[model samples]
Target: MTAGHVPVAVVGGGQAGLSVSWYLGRAGVEHVVLEAQTPVHAWADTRWDNFTLVTPNWHCRLPGYAYDGEDPDGFMTRDEVVQWLAGWLQTFTPPLRNHTRVSTLRPLAAGGFELTLATATGEEVLTCEHAVVATGGYPIPVLPAFAASLDGSITQIHSEQYRNADQLPEGAVLVVGTGQSGAQIAEDLHLEGRQVHLAVGSAPRVARFYRGRDCMTWLADMGLYDKAAPEYPGGKAAIEKTNHYVTGRDGGRDIDLRRFAVEGMRLYGTLSDGKDARLTFEPSLRHALDKADAVYNSILSDIDAFIEREGLGRSVPPATRYSTVWEPDAEVTELDLAAEGITSIVWAIGYRPDYRWIEASAFDGGGRPMQNRGVTEVEGLKFVGLPWMHTWGSGRFLGVDRDARYLADNIIDAHQRKSALESSALRASAHHHLAVAR
Candidate 1:
């Protein structure tokens, strides 16, 4: 059977897809957005009830919809974020298909591409001149293989699966990994008076506010957010660095794991292995905490230097530094889970990208798409929302529009070139016919 066709097929209907659609619509490009789930479902469904954006509201800039809420500096709750995205959808009204899953995306031998989709009704095929994979980077949750060895009596959940402390059985909880989600979720449980034991990873921490303004504001002024991925200190490998942990909960604050230690929360090093009733950890908690502090202080020093260099020292608060509040006395390597009465374990390690459905030969040996600022070597194939796809903010709300605009421009250029070539061919054919008639 013949399949449906379009000029473009956008694979995800999240912010990335919507932003690209906005620009495409403005250019009069005919396209369809296929979403595996409902639009903005991640914001509406994946997050915990008390979850708020780590970044401030002003950063919520989609193509034409910038945040105009009363609280620009304040963070938006999960509900607010969902509502904000929905508002953008209403503005342009792109051709969106929810609950349509793209099972396979492969290049066509005849040109363009083919997408086999499984919708609620049944299976369908689509052919498109261009395909935009805006699925974002983090798709699959990751946990250690040892996670399965834990006692079945104890509850276990990934950070994405966690909602609140009350959902777990009443007892102490062991939260592993100190990334953004792990740190914040640990705080969530600790605040509720739950006994929390946190396994600290090497993820760095940054102060929420510095020198009379939000730390993000300081970084923005210093052009940290605008830094290109290639220009990063460690090169392309730097893009894989874990984000510095902080919090926007309770109207924004620093996540001081040290202070949490002082406040009775237990802290350990990275979790290494787990057995039926026992878990072991590497003795690196002290090193991890110190390393996080070093990054925090490094940022402060850079900002201070910027203030001095820009001659704006008097305008902002006097330069200050963080002093260690508490330290681990000794490395604690093992924990008896059953004896400690720990009823639940929350694994907040991180996520891995899942591109198994993409059957294109456009990836590197590491499975990452080989692209230059969203443009791939393969004709008419592009990716727009992966982390550090162009700049540090490429995948973020602050920069997705720029990436989309770039890709949209490329699509428009291709269309114009094709039209010109066809017109030139028509002129040549007309001349040949006239000569034959003479």
Candidate 2:
């Protein structure tokens, strides 16, 4: 069967895909973006109603689109973010086929790509020289298997499914994972008069306002966000997990587990297991905090080194580390969720991309999409927002655009090269014909 052809087929309509599309459009490339949901569906659908961007407005650097709002330093709320993305779509008017979910993306034996999509109308097939999967930072929410072992009486929700406190049933909330979303949700529930228990791990935190500048500002000044994964003191391992983590509430304040502990929120080590109406936890809270502190200090040290080397001597706030002051092992290990009246469990375990649709040899053994930056093993196949796609900020709002730009440039160069080859071949044929006539 003949498939509709385009130079490029962009899968996913979120910021990543859209950003890539924007670049392609600018370069006059023929491409179609396939969006499963509306643009920015992640923020519009999955995120909580009260969610706000952890990064400040200034850091939301969409290519050719800057945040032109009254508060550059202020964080944008969920709706505002959606609106911005929707507006970006409107401005560029990228060729977006909405409600089109790609069922399969595989390299054809002949050449190029074969795409099968279930769109609003019906099933459709497409062929493109290049394929860009901007599907998501990760495919599905990372949920712990132990969640199912809990008593059926307790309502458990992945951070992705959670809406707001109003929707949750009455009782204490056991928010799992001390990462960004987990910490923010726990703090929100705690401050909103809900007894919150955070299952802490070695998730780091940085003060929103560090020294005389914002944390992001300092990082930017020091080129931390732009640094490639290999440049980190922790090396590529530092970016193996979710590299971005910051709280947006309290007007862009730091919401670490230790701070949550001091503020009356119960902090426990990792939720090791659940069995027979009992929950087991790792006795590593202090170790976790130390690890978290280490990351923060590492970053700050980098900034300090930058300041010293550049001769930009700027006085900064003194370092103030949060002390847990509580023994992790001694803290309540086994807790009966039902007996403790824990009505809700917010699992903020994190996310992993679902590239099952892709049949190309572009993913690694661990299922992570493998590529040299955005360029994959399969020629003309690329990924835009995977963790460490190119840099620490690769999966971030400010970084996706850069990755998109690179992918677009890469595709365009290939196209030009193809065109050049064809032109040279045609010229050779013409000269041969003339020679034969003579």
Q: What tens digits encode model 2's per-residue C-alpha lDDT throughout 1-438?
A: 336999899998878888988888998889999988777777888878778888888878777998889988888999999888777766778898889888998898887998998976788889988999887657788877777877887787889888888788999999988777887788778878998988886677776776566788877776767877678657765666544357776578766666667667787888889964678888777777777777776667766677678766646655444445444446667777778778878999887767887888877777887777788788778888776778777878879889889888998898889889999999999999999999
For each candidate, what TM-score against the reference?
A: 0.97, 0.93
Largest TM-score belongs to which candidate?
A: 1
Relative to the true structure, how large is the alpha-carbon lDDT of every model?
Answer: 0.91, 0.80
Model 1: lDDT equals: 0.91
Clashes of 2: 1
Best by lDDT: 1
Error of 2 at 205 (Å): 1.6
Candidate 2 residue 89 Cα shift, in angstroms, is: 2.1
- How many steric overlaps are in each model, in order? 0, 1
Please list the residue runs of candidate 1 whose C-alpha ends up more than 4 Å from where it truly belongs after superposition. Answer: 434-438
Which ranges of candidate 2 are over 4 A from the true structure?
310-329, 427-438
- Alpha-carbon lDDT of model 2: 0.80
